[model samples]
Target chain A: MALLEVMNVGIAFGGLQAVSQLDIKLEKGHLYGLIGPNGAGKTTVFNLLTGVYRPTEGDIILDEKNITGKSPAKINQAGIARTFQNIRLFGEMSVLDNVKIGLHNQIKYSAFTGIFRLPGFKEKEQEMDYKALKLLKIFDLDTVAQSPASSLPYGKQRKLEIARALATNPKLLLLDEPAAGMNPSESEELMNTIKFVQKEFDVAILLIEHDMNFVMGICEHIYVLEYGRIIAQGNGESIRNNPRVIAAYLGGD
Target chain B: MNAIKNLKPSTCNNLINYGMVLVFYIVVQILVNAGVLNNSMQGMLVPICTYVVLAVSLNLTVGILGELSLGHAGFMSVGAFSGAIFWMISGSQMSPVVGFTLAIMIGGIFAGIFGALIGIPVLRLRGDYLAIVTLAFGEIIKNLLNAIYVGWDSNGFHFSMKDVSALGLDESGEVIVNGAIGITGMPKASTFTAGTILVIITLFVILNLITSRAGRAIMSIRDNRIAAEATGINITKYKLMAFIISASFAGMAGVLYALNFSTLAAKKFDYNTSILVLVFVVLGGIGNIRGSIIAATVLYVLPELLRELQDYRMLIYAVVLIAMMIFNQSPQVLAWRSNFVSKISRSGIAARFIKQKRQSEEV
Candidate 1:
């Protein structure tokens, strides 16, 4: 069984169907790419999966559990975590603190314990600091851990978001335009980070990217989306040769 | 031990806040002992403490929680009445320490309950809508308290809203709360020491919560609600928690303020009082805890000190408010201030002065 199975999921906003009949199966530890044109409902799909919007129809099962229509927080706790397309970071927080926020549910202490600064609270916080620092170190963000999230360069901010997402210990990770606004070199580095994250974290990765080179270079299987529907689904070789994929990107004559 | 070493910066910062409060307490003690403080100055101490507590607690909502609450005075009013009522009923029966402690706790708990009640619905609304609803809630609380009349008699506690006569109290009964007039003849158990102690406690709870997991969650929501939610944080739980904690502390401040006076009026905790606390928060630099403490103390005490200014006092206050606003917020001023601070630190002026003092002492 796949780690994630979006079985015929669809969402409509009144007169408009934002996304429809989206079926994708991602096995554990595999890297998948979701490629599409502008306004092709890529982010809307992510929002539906993360329960930002309850699907008007269909079930989203993660690790054999049906998690459709659950709140974003609950969906995350159910082992699916996602980064936003527009880099929605906790900008005012320190980079280290941002990742620690990701570890919020994994380690728990009561509010009373926190306010009182009990021994248990101290121990838990130390543990969290250790864990958060370890995660930051992986992305080479440990040096600037004390710096505010917004102060980091754009490329590093994107990396920090991914690191924050991975801190949730999810069974599946979704990256929405993770390479957006990055130069070619930064995109190349991001591709390596995504590949590393899949291998080390052992979570299935589903990412949406507009950069064809970045997508084809890293993704084992790719899904091409246009007009809120998948135009093609296959490995990079098959996806590149498919006439429909070419026409969607280059525009039909 | 190594983990502790790693925690030095934040721990040291917290220590500095506590130390500053302790130093202030000691200096004030010295001044009072030396007879340097006047009668009026001494009298202003407890009120200053009360405002300090109010400012800090309100910061937890307005600054850290990232919500504008115009009903903080409402919570304070609830606490004051509830605490005063408890004291009137049981204070004479117990030791002063025990009675005062219980009174404030009752006040805080009552206010916290009200916070939970108001926060549940009010928190669903964000930004300006939240502010307006909170303002309305504050007015509602004040008006409701004004109409309430409660007395204790052989028939136990009696409550009536129409008037005191409708309470049907026995001849032996004494009114604890009279409509409009509010609570009177209450014990003035609040002292400067108690007020300072409450300030310290407020600082402890708030500062500790800020660095904790719960604090992180609350701050994340403030920084970015969507990101926080995506990170598996229960937005409502943390938001409500911060709001209640803030309300509870505001209530405690009210209790402290009420006990210091012989008479307590619900009207005192009006919208203006809420705005005054907010002014402290804003001028202090929102989300800056130490700044709030300093701002509250200086701003609250400034008017008292300026009594001699007479006609010029109000004009002077407006100027000072603008000055503080620019000093705290203006981009050019902020850059200059940061540069000044960095230059001072890099020049090692304080460090050199400390070294010289140590050498002279050793000699």
Candidate 2:
């Protein structure tokens, strides 16, 4: 069975259909890519999958459980985490504290315990600190951990977003335009980091990237979307040669 | 082992903080009782203690947790009335210590329930709309209390404050709340020690809350709600928790205020008090507990100190606030001040003495 199955999902806002009749299945441990031209409903699919917007039709099943219409927090708690297309770090907070928020759901303490500094509260807090630090170290952010998140360079900020999402211990990770505004060298490095995360962390990844070369290099499978519909799906070579994908890219169909 | 080493300083800091609080409380008690301070000074000190608690606790909702709640006075009123009523019914029979404890707890409970009720619906709204709604709720509660009659007596229609001294006694004779005139002839219950101890406890709770994981979570939400939500932090749950906690603290402050005054006036907890508390949070650095305490004390005392200035008191206040705004807003001014301070410190004879001492010790 697929790890995440979307069977005929549809969503509409008012009179306009943002997404219509979309079906996609992601198997466990695979790096998948979703790519399309501008205004192709690529982000709408990500939103629908991550529970940012409830699909008007069809089912979203993770593993074997139907997870349609769940709140974003619940969906994230159920082991799915996603990054925004735009960088959305807690800009005012220290870099380490930014990742610490992802560890909140796993921390075991009530507000009373926190308020009073109950014995167990200290222990759990130390554990969360250690975990947040470990994640920061993995992303090479440990040196800048004390700096405010807004002070970080653009590339580091993007990496920090991924580290924060991973801190949630997600089963599936989604990257929305992870390489939207990176130099060619930075994009190359990010592609390797994405592969490394999938391999080392053993988490499934689904990325939406407008960078064709980056996506084609890292993704094991690719799905092409156009105007709220999937025009093609296959391995990298197959997708690269598909006539419909080529026509869609050439603005012919 | 590494974690243990890193954790040592924080633990030591916690112990030191508690010790300091105890020492401070003892010193304040001694000063108040030794005839070194007058009754008017004590009166001013009592509200400072309560407002310190109120301002720091309210920061949990307003500054750190990022919710705009203007209904803090509503919770204070609830606590004040509930505490007053509790004391009126049971105070004379019980020891003052027990009566005070029970009254404060009763007040906190009623205020907490009301806080949760108001938070549930209003927390759904964001920013200025939430502020306006809570402000309206506070006024509505105040007006409602003013309109209702609690009982009927020889003096005609009895309200909350009427006959307060006569209702608590047994079949012999007693009073609970005086009708409409407000609670009268009640024994003064708040002492310097009680107020100081409560303030210490409040400071302890607020300090711990800000440093803990949950405290950090609330702050993170305040800093960036979208990022916090994306990380699986429940925005609504944390916001409501802040509101309820802040309201409960405000309630506790109300109880202490009532005990200090030995009465409750419907007019005592108006919108002006709420604005005053908000000013305390802002003038103090937002999310800084120590700042809140200092700000509350200074702001509360400043008005009394400036009373001699009479008509110019408000003008002076406006000028000072405008000056603070200007000082805070101008980056160049801040930079110049810092540079000046650094240059003086580095060039002074004190710096040379310290440097020589360090060099001699190393030799």
Candidate 3:
């Protein structure tokens, strides 16, 4: 069975259909890309899948469990995690703590145990710390684990956010414009990291990116969206050369 | 088990705080027993402890949860009146021990229930709107108390809103509470020791919650609500949890206030009192439990100590507040505090506490 399936998803706000009849599917460990011009409703589809918005009509099934319209937190605990188009780390907290929060669903210590300084509180906390450190290490962020998240450089902030998302132990990961402001070299580095994460974590990826090179370089399958509809979708080579995709990006007078 | 062996700063921090409270309690009690403290100084002890509980709990709402609550005093009044009624009803047959203990329990529970009730609706609104709604609730509660009347005797229990005459109690009936006048001639059952114990419990609960997974979720919400929600943390549940816990502690403070004094009036807990508690949380450095405790105790005592300087008292108080604001927000001071904290965690009591715990586990 496929790991995730989105069937006939549709949504509208004030008579304007933001997305309609969107269908997608993913097998385990697959790398997929969603690309579009500005305001192409790519993010709207992501918001619907992550439960930030309820589809006006559709079903979102993960591992055969219909997860449409659930709370964002519930959708996350169901083994999907995402990074924002704009990085949203908890600025005042340490880098380690930002990652640790992603592992919130995995901790088991009760209020009683926490209050009484019971053995379980200690063990669970220490284990989480170790796990958080390991995640930081993967992104070369272990050295600055004690620094506040906002203190990190912009590129590092993006990497830290991705690391934090991975700490959620997701079966499916979503990246929203992961290479938004990076130069060519930095975008190249991010592409490598994306591929590494898909391979090492064995997690299916659905990333929204405007950067064609970044998306085409790493994605096995690509879906193109424009004006709340899927204009075209195919393997990277086919979507890149598709006339409709080119026309949407390079608009006519 | 291994987490305990690591002896995280929170565990050691609680221990250090407990010691401070315990030592302070003993020293003050000893001073009173030895007559080293004058009558006025003695009178201030219970209030100090009560305000400590109030400030620390308020910190949970204002500091940690990052929500403003202007009806904390309303919850306190709920606890104060309920607790006072219990103490009065049981005064005849029961010992003061049972009366006061039951009073605290009933008071805390009622305050907590009201906290949840009010929070469910009010929490839906954020920032200034919440503050306005809670402020309105506080005023409403104060006015409600002014209209309530309660009495009891062999005939039955009586309660009325309009007037005492409407209660229709016979000559044998005893009036426990009368409209506006409130409870008077109540037994002074709130002791310094009881207040001290309450403070300890408040610290334990607050400290424990802050270190636990639940606390992390709450703080995460405060730091970034949308991000926290995206991380799968239930925003409403944790926000309500913090609010209710904070309210109940304020309720416990109200119980202490009622028992420590001879008369109980809802008017004592109004907008001013709520603001006073907020100031304690703020001056102490929001979300810092130890800072809140010290700030509350010292700030409460300042007015009494300035009694001799009556004419210039308010002036000095203003000056002190301004100084505190500067000291609290100064960049140099904040940098110094963070450095001090890291040092303390590395080689201070935290290190020693961890070592001791490990040694005990091995033995």
Best candidate according to DockQ: 1
After superposition, the stretches of candidate 2 with alpha carbons farther than 4 Å from their true spots are B1-36, B149-175, B178-180, B326-363
Q: Chain B alone: TM-score in each candidate?
A: 0.93, 0.79, 0.94
Candidate 1 local lDDT, A1-253, one digit each (tens) = 9888998988889989888999989998999999988999899988988989999888999889999989999999999899988888999888989999999988899989998877798789878888988888888898888878999998899999999999999998999989989999889887887888789888998899888898999999999889899889999999999999889888986
Give the DockQ (2 decimals) of all models: 0.73, 0.63, 0.56
Residue-level lDDT tens digits of model 2 in B1-363:
233233333444455556655676677678877988776776787788789888988888888887777877878888887787778767646998988988888888888888999889999898999999999988876766554434334444334433343333334443444444556666778876777777787777766776777777788788877677768888888887788878888888888888887567767788998888888887775665655776788778877878889999988887766665455435686578658865865797545655565557459
- Which regions of candidate 3 are displaced past 4 Å? A182-189, B1-7, B91-93, B170-172, B340-363
Q: Give the TM-score of candidate 2.
A: 0.88
Error (Å) of candidate 1 at residue B213 is 0.6
Please write out the lDDT profile of model 3 over residues A1-253, one tens digit for every residue: 8999999999999799999989898989999999989998988888898899999998999989999989999999998898888788888777888888888888767767876778777778888899988878778888888778999999899988898889888999999988888889989988888888899999999999888888889899999998998889889999978999989999853
TM-score of 1: 0.96
Report the C-alpha lDDT of model 3 over B255-358, residue by residue, as the tens digit.
99899998997788889999998898899888778878988887899888887999999899888887776667677998997799789868877677778876
The runs of at least 3 residues in candidate 1 whose Cα sits more than 4 Å from the true structure, single-residue gaps closed, are: B1-7, B338-363
Query: Top TM-score: which candidate number?
Result: 1
**Span of ten consecutive residues with least summed lDDT in model 2 chain A:** A117-126
